[model samples]
Target chain A: MHWKEDSAEEGDLLRNALAGCEKAWADLFRMHYHRVYAFAFRSGLSAEDAEDAAQEVFVKAARYLETFKGDSAFKNWLYGIAHHAVMDLLRKRGRREVLLERLHENDTTSKCSAAAKHTEVGDVLGQLPDDLRMAVVLIYYEGKTHKEASKIMDCAETTVSWRIYIAKKRLRKLLEKRG
Target chain B: MKDDPIEKYLVKLEVPTPQQEAVERALHRSTLAFKNRVEPKITQRENTVFKWFEKYYLAVAFAIVFAAFASFFPWAERVCPAASETSDLLAIYSEVKMLFQNNLVAVLLQGSELKVQLGVPRNVAGARVMFVEFSRGDEKIKVLCLEGSALRVPLQGKVQPVLEAMPTADGGVILMGDSFVWSRAMPQTINGYNISARLL
Candidate 1:
């Protein structure tokens, strides 16, 4: 209920912000800062970098309010921005290097997944390949209907079904391997 | 895959440490903060993909712009343009086109006429941002609350008499006989089958 209200309010704030309403920008800040922050953190940036990236995301978002599209929900749209900002930050570090790091990064799988639905999971879930990872994130963590996930992923429901099958098997395998 | 029991036990976690409420509140605060600073164009897990670009932003931007310009010149199209153009080569061009092409939504600038805007902007944010107005036609009924491009959110209800939208600068679009310029689209935000009108 709160999230729905919060998003709806954020929608209004975004609308107001575009119209140059004074409180609107403040309201936007109050609403999405930490989600952006957590998003940055979960994407593999250090705390300081996450903070900087979060700030970067908002700054860009505010500057481009004129381009806001109500197409997807406001929140999904914003995630797209934060995703870019985080990517930009990491890209600044270089793609080959980042991938090499991920390929070689020490395991942190022991960390329990966040109880909070939207935290690092956004990063982790998105971290996976479109097939195995996306399904795991949506079904296992996000608790979305496979049907809904299929819509977002633009895959056939059966593909989602198969992906989820492989994803869970892989996840359990990963967890056991990690343990 | 359907009968897989592990799917049942996968585990459903809440948003965070406190409650979904606390995390939501924190996220909301973060959104406000983030928006106060910079409002970027697109945010998606693909953003991480962009991080790969940042390392070579200038190079990438240069490559993209150069490529766009090259592609736009219809140079390759003029050449061999036939069936054997080059498989991998054309594929790259298609991928590049997708970047700037469909992101736009349509706007009817004048009566019985329309324009395709390249980007989404404040002028049309939260308005219908789709080719077919993603929602049903339920939002066009009794509430006519906009003047030119300005919105009266508080007074938004059912649109009566089916008010017409004016041409405005927004995300940016390509109109007939018009060169590239940033312009806004009308508020047809939720282009659903049933959205004849909207609440806000």
Candidate 2:
């Protein structure tokens, strides 16, 4: 479901959670956990790393709850935090080079199994630069609009469009070379 | 418009789903963290105070150093011998510092008219005092004034001589310095022996 449709319910859950309601906290966590996990994964983290990133995002959100000004949707604010958390995880692991090497290796191998295809796609995404990767992940994989993705990425909406343009061009070249 | 080939390809590609047990584990850990959340209002207040300190620490340090230097070797003492009466001069300097601290200097400087008065206390013989009053809009402030004779004292300290004292036609003197001017005149007595004094 779109975040807008559930925004009022989510806001109530967030308010209750902040008010120390355990059930509300559980409900809020269950609501966004998968999406945040998927965001982390699509942002070039491994499954385990994504889980760690998601956990860190929620912890940080709780810790800095007062900083949430309600200027933006809660989901976008959460995604902004998620963006930083995922980037920090990736930087800490120094996984870009490894992912690139895996991408090159997978390009030469047969695209047979579903698991292999999944890893190949992730590796291909990881091969893109961090900014371009984020643009693609937020706009394409996560189905965020340019405006919403700009909020998540903390950049101008035009910058988001430009980054997506560059990312798609790069991805096209990479895929064509692989074929 | 038809979907781009790349978009079609990416959309069709199945991303791996997170394992159910892993999601449960993350939820458990996150909920525990959420339950034990720190009080954000306290954290935000502390952060604001720290930010304020970070921004003004240098200015605050300089103000401290200036205050210490001014107290030890006051500007009044360097300009005039009568100002060597450090106790009285320092008291006036302390008053000036209070005015500065309370952001009253601007108001005093920009006051509409300058009124000067001189009086001697009934009990204190040979001790003359001057009152300088300033009015800004409806606000009135009166500051203790020092004599031009005080500024005529020979320079004795390493401090640069900056004060200019101009005597007025009516036996009043105007003492001009870097940022302020103080005007004073001879004592004015109301009754033959009863000279009322107003101390700030």
Candidate 3:
């Protein structure tokens, strides 16, 4: 199933998965794994932690599938689950110090290639406030609109736009600082 | 888009993809967990008296209303006496909860240890009424309006009632009086007030 967000709004795939359809479950996993993994990574979890969180999130979603009630987009509901998983991991790891250190490491990973500038630019991305960083990741990286990002983040669309605007301003300042 | 500096960095930002084997393993385990949690609930619901009541409570309520309309029996003057006779406020509350689940506006409170949901029903005795469910662990207590009547819900243990709900502008009263823990049925009203006042 192509599972477009628009089509998936009726939640047939979710209903099928809840009824123990293994194929439906696998298709949902394939469709969501990359986005969930990306969100986890951008939320400052390590590769290993992100993978674990993704799996944990899917399992929790499956367990609670019946309670979904279809009040929002399935993708938005999935993102809410991912947010809780990331928050749990962050709480376990202790928040600011670990997050800043992991973000700093993103800047140093590639030294002698074209990738280095991109990695350095990511330093500003990493330094943005958590909510702003999430807005940038969902909109700029994941190709979601501000409205979709707002639903996933459980905030108003205006809040999403303001976060994106603030992130852009802060990123500009960081670039100047690096220059 | 390629010239946008922020876009360039985001495009290059490395996100690790889950390997096929790892994803398959997780999916298999999740399927098992889903079956374990959901299947039992389905089966248990099949056998539960509560489920029976939930499935047929509406039918029973309608039948009672019809019987009341056709009777000269003074008992018919009391609507839903069968439900009241049981003196089980919790049971009646559950049936009402199911009847109004879709119309309830869930109020979410922050930083509260207890899971509290408060909402008003769409219709009750030609008036809108509010209810709250307080849940901790496997036990949940629901304080709901009873149209024209009120029943006293008993407190459990040493817990004293602390919070009182004020009447809204819409003629709907919230549960009021000194806060009493509504853990179980009392089978007796502490007063002669309608069920709405007792719930409030």
User: Evaluated with DockQ, which candidate comes out highest?
Assistant: 2
Runs in model 1 deviating more than 4 A are A1-8, A87-165, B1-200
Per-residue lDDT value at A66 in model 2: 55
Candidate 1 chain A weakest ten by summed lDDT: A103-112
lDDT (10s digit) by residue, model 1, range A1-179: 11233356676776677667757776676566666665555554544456677666666666666666565555555556766676667668743454444333224321224433322233344344534654564455444577755655566889989987776666566545535
Instruction: Point out the higher-scoring one by TM-score: 1 or 2.
Output: 2
lDDT of 1 at B6: 47
Question: lDDT tens digits, residues B48-143, model 3?
Answer: 787888899999999999887869787767777645633564454455457556443322222333122334433444433335444444444555
lDDT of 3 by residue, A32-69 (tens): 77788778876766656777888888888777777665
lDDT of each: 0.47, 0.65, 0.62
For each candidate, what's the DockQ? 0.09, 0.38, 0.19
Worst 10 residues of 1 chain B by lDDT: B174-183
User: What lDDT tens digits, residue by residue, belong to model 1 across residues B89-184?
Assistant: 334334543655544322322223333334332344445321112233333222222222222121133431222333335433211112212123
TM-score of chain B of each: 0.17, 0.27, 0.22
- Model 2, which residues run further than 4 Å from truth? A1-8, A97-113, B42-51, B54-59, B66-200
Sorted by lDDT (best first), the order is 2, 3, 1
